[model samples]
Target: MRARILSVKVGHVTGLREQKKQATRAALGAAALRLAWERGPENVRVDDIAEAAGVSTRTYNNYFSSREQAIVAAVIADRESRVAAAVVGRDADVGLGEAVIDAVAGQYEDEGGRDALLMITGSPALRACYIDTVAAIEDPLAEAIVERCPGVDTLTAQVLSAGVGAAVKVALRQWLRPTSMPGFVMVSGSVTDLLRTALTPLRPALEAAGDTEVSRCRL
Candidate 1:
């Protein structure tokens, strides 16, 4: 589990084996996403994902309980890559406004990043599963928020976390839908305009939040 691994990294030794396991798990996830794309998530199978990843079905079982978990893994992996990139660019010198601008704008610039949005938008079951994942993230998210924003209540943290999660996702969903022409350019403009209006009060913080560098705990 992510929680256990974090605890271990705090004290327990990290080993090559653990690293390999993580790599294999990631491969399995990529495989699952590929299958989901090829044939809707509902039709995708655990064995198919495992075979695509070139790992055994048993290994797949060890890592994920079902195809949905693998979809979750793919979503999580994309987020990890984005956050890792964001942290690299983040600094105390950057104003919250610019950060927010960057975060919101990055959604438009990253053409490759639309896959998750497309997957969620295209599949009803995956969308529901993603909602469940959002619900489950409260505990860990609140813990992280407490560390960053001292004096916050865990309950409030959870609510804030889930609200933000829902907002970002809804924003993406609206953007992805064809109410507008073309893909991201229109989507980007609309989301930017909507977000700009919605978070006008905390524009700077929102801009800072907009930076793709923090967490996809939302989308």
Candidate 2:
């Protein structure tokens, strides 16, 4: 009983710590975005964001690597996990490919509107950071694929998720391509459409994995 109680107390403490960290991260991201929007990304320094968030510069460093990353985080906060959750939460009847593509496109469909999109695209540094964020989807997405397809091996799931990440990166890159004009980028097409087109090639692989027999494969 004492061991169980101690374990429970420890878990509670750990949960509280995680919550506090998330709150701090959110605060910092919000401050970074607000500052960037108001003063431009180039003018918003790490010190400025930290001071706005009421945390030390050291604390800000612990959460984010750059002002651009923090600003992007505010625009797409917890999006990676939400993508995975959406994939997992889909009805069993839905094809794995459709579910994944829909989840990704839907989550990103309304991210921050025209102002935020323009701000991110106008700066090369911010555009690079934004593109890099797509990689974060792999781990959670791998888990979701495995859950949705019990026969899928860890390695296979990881590979598929990596493919998905790659596709998303391509889509984002195309959508945010730079124009001939300096510091100007054209929004070429709808991001959702680009994502769908990019991901469509992977549908067969996803469906095959989903249809894999448990007897023929090891999870």
Candidate 3:
């Protein structure tokens, strides 16, 4: 009982630390975005961001290594709230693929909308930062899939998630470039179509095989 009490105390301490960290990160991110919006990405400096966030420039450095990272933190914050709360049991009917589509569409629709799309197509800094963010998005989707699909096994879930993540990134990259369709429809159709076209028959077949394997194990 004493050991259990100790463990609980440790867990509480850890949670407090995480909460503080998240608060700091959010403040810094807000400062960066405010500065970026006011002066554009190029004019914003780390000191300006630190001042706006009410943190020391050193604290800003500790949270984000660069001005670009500050921008990224802002981008992620804007996107995260919109990401469908479909991680595992939050919405059992929502498959990871569909959930991902919903989440990404939200990002594409926000402040990083059509105009940001055009800017990203040309801006080297935005491009580099987006590439990094895509990888981060991919990892979480992978874990979410494993959590959502019981008996899916780790390796298989990881591989499937990776393929889905890659497809989403590719579609996002394409959509980020063109304004071909009537506003939002362009990306929605393009991304879903791209994934469907690329993985059509192969994906279904693999899924069936996986199901059979799982069933056999159960038997």
Candidate 4:
């Protein structure tokens, strides 16, 4: 009875710690974005972000590698987390290609997504950071892919996820380029169309790896 009570107490403490850490991280990212929007990326300093987040510069460094990463994190908000959740919530029978494509493309179907895209595309530095930020999705996505297809190896899942990341990078570069008129010109079609087209080459890999039979055979 004593051990059980202690265990519950420990679990509660750990949960609270995790929540606090997440709050700090979110605060730093939000501060970074707010500063960047007000002063532009080139002018926003690490100290400024730290001050706005109500933490020391050292604490800010603990959360992000650089100011750009923090800004990108703020810009992305929780969309990557949403993508992973969406993928995880899908029916087990859904093919990897369909699951991933839909999860990513579905994010852009909302008004908030459109605003993020416009904000990101308007600045070259932020756009580049946006492209780089997609890499953050690889690990969680690979884990989710492997969970849905347990027969698939971790390495294979990682490779497929990397391919997906690369496709997104390429597609965004094409879709967010600047025009002579100034500001970002939306490329000719929907971002969803561009993403799907970019992702088309990975269909074979996604299908084969996601197939239970193929996964088992390779194992």
Local lDDT at 188 for model 3: 42
Leading candidate by TM-score? 2
Model 2, global lDDT: 0.90
- Return the TM-score for candidate 2, rounded to 2 decimals: 0.95
lDDT of 1 at 154: 63
Question: What lDDT would each prediction earn against the true structure?
Answer: 0.57, 0.90, 0.60, 0.80
Best-fitting candidate, scored by lDDT: 2
Candidate 3 stretches greater than 4 Å from native? 78-84, 87-107, 111-122, 177-210, 213-219
Worst 10 residues of 3 by lDDT: 210-219
| Model 2 / residue 115 / CA error / Å | 1.6
Worst 10 residues of 1 by lDDT: 179-188
Candidate 3 residue-wise lDDT, 1-219, digit = tens: 999999999999999999998898989888886787778878889999999988899988898888877776776663533432444434544444545545444454444455554444455576567656655555565555555555666676567656655665666565554454432223444444554554443355334423554523211
Model 1 vs. true fold: TM: 0.55
Question: Taking the tens digit of each residue's C-alpha lDDT, what string does model 1 give over 50-163?
Answer: 999998999999988889878867775544334224423456565434443354345334333567756665655655565455344344444544443344456655655455
User: lDDT at 80 for candidate 1?
Assistant: 30
TM-score per candidate, chains pooled: 0.55, 0.95, 0.72, 0.82
lDDT of 4: 0.80
lDDT by residue (1-219, candidate 4, tens digit) is: 999999999999999999999999999998887887788777889999999989999999898878888887876777777777777778766777888888877765642456556666677777777778888888888887877777889999899989998998888878776688865566657877888999988988888887758565221
- Note each model's CA RMSD in angstroms: 8.4, 2.2, 5.4, 3.5
- Which residue pairs does candidate 2 place in steric collision? none
